[model samples]
Target: MGDTDGAEKLLEEAFYNQPFNKDIVTLVFSFYMDTADYRKLIKVAQRCMAFHLADRLCWHRLGTAHFYIGEYQSAVLAFRRSLEIEHNPKASFGLSQPLLALGLYEEGFNRFEERFVANPSINWIRAEKMHMPKWQGEPLAGKSILIWSEQGLGDSIQFSRLLAVLSAQGALVDLILHPHHSDLEGVLSTVAGINSIILIAGNRFKLQRRYDYHCPMMSLMGILKLTPAIEVANEAYISTPASHKNKWFEYQERPEKKIGIVWSTALSDAFLKEHPMHAAAKVKKSIALRQLEPLFHLSHCCFFPLQIAISEEDRQYLSKYDNICDVSEKLSTFSDTAAMIDEMDLVISIDTSVAHLAGAMGKETINLLGYVSDWRWQQNREDTPWYASMSLYQQTFEGNWEQPVNKLVRLLQ
Candidate 1:
């Protein structure tokens, strides 16, 4: 543990000295997983016997390793063993995911509640009184529901569409959106049955503020059974951005098909660097700029580069694109990106927030995905149920985006 190189040398010598030692192999697996080495963990996990472990820690580790490697069912079995040894709530929590992955919704959700605590962290947040209104699975004739935004901006944006769904079900919805999204308040407030929309700017929340129930915004998607085929939100539902209307008037002659480009994924930098086709994108804003080049050259298309504040080297790369038009001077927030997206005919991007934004805005978006995308995208499909307007162009081989880019070139032709 003191020195990684030294430890690896010692471990290699020790393993060579005792090749048949299962305990040593398990220890190595634990160490690898701890260091985020999924490939090695998979190899070690395949070799280890589940029942031979000293404690449930090995099972938990095995389960976690399986989970990371996309072996969800195996993870569930391992986590269940850990749970059976002792009534561990967190282990139960672990079981819920693999169960949900296998489409055991009701059983998974039931186990999920056992993992819920009034307050899991003592330092981050104080223990609650549990006064947060319980959703009793009652009729929502005139009941008010306060939907709070949790997680990141992209998540909030993706889930915000639920307000309409909840409202349609006869619930008076009060949206507590993040302050950075205050610009979206106007857009969101216009939706039917959304009684009020407020930004979370250090305001005191009263539990008894006439709300019958409260739920996280994302949970509604599951509640509504909005899977890929069932997902059909009104394309006209989103509100148009007011700010870009005046800015776009000057560029009306620009083209009939304008598209913005963003090409980079936010998954760990090391994982991102491993993909050679996206090697040029390590320069941060080079992706947003370089990808816009093709769109810029097309006189029939107006190209808007969305993200800004890039390193100087990336700016130099972007400077070489002769047709580059600067929108770094225009984009301020996701709303600004949404506005630019609204004015565009299509969006071509890597796995990023811009893709999520374009999809939520119901714009025809082409998402350039790496060989392995997140679990939400699952394994197969050209389209995501989460965004009907979005189309996917996925890498056929690991660490390669050339195939997707070539496919995009053919489609664009």
Candidate 2:
């Protein structure tokens, strides 16, 4: 903490001494970026651009700051200007995010490939070892294709709709997924065209059969020419086993409106250190247990905690509420969470896997988002095209959940 304070103080003094110096400006901007201080980054970026009007790096910094704040239009313009000065792969990739967020599907989808090309350390790229050619929207009739899961479990669930599409195209679809997601085999087996589901053995994948082509699950969006509506329309695609649903029902007493709530997102230590902006936003997304006091005042509504893990502080805080059922112990896997969500009238959650699960399952999910949410939620939207059954309640101002929570309270009433 002292080192951080000292570094910040030095940067501030440098900026004050050489207000128009590009090097000092760059250093200060980088400091704010590393700290995930977007507001300060914006102010510094604007000041830097005032003097270094022709600097491509300054424009790139400005664009990144705007992107983090959910200002897509400004981000787009800033990125474009940076590119006009010098064609940069990183800047090009940055441009795609805002384009996708604004629903410019074609351009965004086309440019999204830059992510893999620019950042080789991305999880999907690291896991991939296949030397085979990637399928590029070609006719797959009589061709065998492998679709491998990438990113988070929620991403795998959300993109699993493409398996049926691949099957419909007459391609033999073989899926490779994480072993932990084995519970989904029964659910996904029902998709029309899947020939087999293979789980990754430890960190390595061994395939029994060779395929003509392989594609990452998310690549289907661009390769298959999918529209947002088509993506969200597959509401009945994922279903909880009847037995699991029945078990959940028997386990808990029924309420008029059983609202499943997930307060905080799980973040690994390494991930938080690597992505300070995401870490900062995650802290903001974690609404305090006491902040939800207004919802408990409503009649005939019971809140079920769907988080898999909770901090000791949170556990002790939740002990105060009798109406809020602590089901964290019972939620051992995604399947268990799904089964409970299957019985819920409404799911009120932060931007987490639970929101994705409820959305994919076609549950009426009210997803609470931070001021600047994930790109999937898009910008300034109440409803997402990614999930027809999901309604987004975003923070109008940073760190303020009062408005969205009050909206939720009114809805519950």
Candidate 3:
């Protein structure tokens, strides 16, 4: 039978007839899971347990099926049972996430530390250990601390705040920053405690020994216990003589609120794969353009794409909008992006590097979020704790932007 309901009915009859048959039970249970009939799957799985046919795989399924259906507590119980029978690596990973989601932090962090062992990324497996540097707070007279950037450009910029704080704390900080962000190094080096800057990919640092204490950039957020309540400078922190060229002083001279728009999605494929807190469940050019259309219409906004040349459908959508301006083809470096963003009063962007730029500059930012967002943002809140000036506007439902965009338009007005 081609109909899923028909297949399900037939499986139910067969399961009733031969309830203890492992092969038949597995097939029917798999079908139930695939069809997303979680309640039925649970019943079938329980029957397997009653028949003493419970296996590691079945228990894993039982736990994850509950997890998928939002029965997190029950999912935890099932996952524990799965672990009791046999150590299932995937189940450990699965158990870790829901526990974290439920705010079981101490336990969750312990489990998160096992990510490399339970299930590791390819990079983790192949990644060469760079002799984990130490951050020794001793000897204010001579020791250097290396601040290593991690994850994405946004992360680097967001955590760069720590550099200033640590520098002020009287440590001689040396930054290991992304080459793209080296334009920021000069300003960053001038921070109260920083002694030098080294671009990780470009410059060679001659040192007597490795850094005293090495910190991945993200950990600074937790270390500082930074929340939205922290006060920040309301002006730009980085500037360059190069960015000053062709800089529209006249635009600054005017009274109009100049806003920058960044519509191009970054890491589109990576996000689509994980679907963690998925904002855009899938990438459809028409939908992406529609999500962005409202920003272009704002009178105070100057819409800019840091990049062009997505799908043809997206290109056509851009063609239809007269206000969309992309000088990204000419802007290859963060310095150029910084120069343009410097001229703007605010930035309205998707979750991209432009958001990072705006946040780092202490510009007012409104981040357009997809329905399912990243894990870092957590659930529904209008503001992020990481950036003081940044506010979030999220899609209420998946693959729908009208309501959110309408909300943004009203906010813009």
| Top model number, lDDT | 2
Task: Please state the error at residue 322 of candidate 3 in Å.
Answer: 3.6
Error of 2 at 128 (Å): 7.7
Residue-wise lDDT of candidate 2 within 1-413, one digit each (tens)? 69989999999999978987768887898899988787788887777666664478878888888988889999999999999999887888898888988888777877777777767655442434666778898898999998877667677777888788888888999987766556566556545567888876565656787788988888889887777765435565677755566658664567557889988888876889888876787787789877888998775887889997788888888777666778889887677888888878889999887888888788999999999887777878999877889999999998899999999988888
Clashing pairs in 2: none
Model 3: runs farther than 4 Å from truth? 1-111, 115-143, 177-194, 200-209, 221-257, 268-287, 294-301, 307-313
CA deviation > 4 Å runs, candidate 2: 1-5, 19-23, 123-129, 178-192, 230-234, 242-245, 251-253
Candidate 1, pairs of clashing residues: none
Best first by TM-score, ranked: 2, 1, 3
User: What is the lDDT of every predicted structure here?
Assistant: 0.62, 0.80, 0.63
User: CA RMSD for every model?
Assistant: 5.4, 2.5, 6.3
Candidate 1 lDDT, 1-413, residue by residue in tens: 46966776676567556656776766686557545566666555554454353356657777776765567888888898887787677777777767755656566656655444422631111213435564535667777887766545566666677677677778888877655556566545544557787665543444436567777665565555554335546354554456444455555566456677775443455755565333423432223434434444555554566654444666677676554555766776555666677667778877676777778777888987655454456555698777878888876665556567667666665
| Model 2 vs. true fold: TM | 0.91
Ranking by lDDT: 2, 3, 1
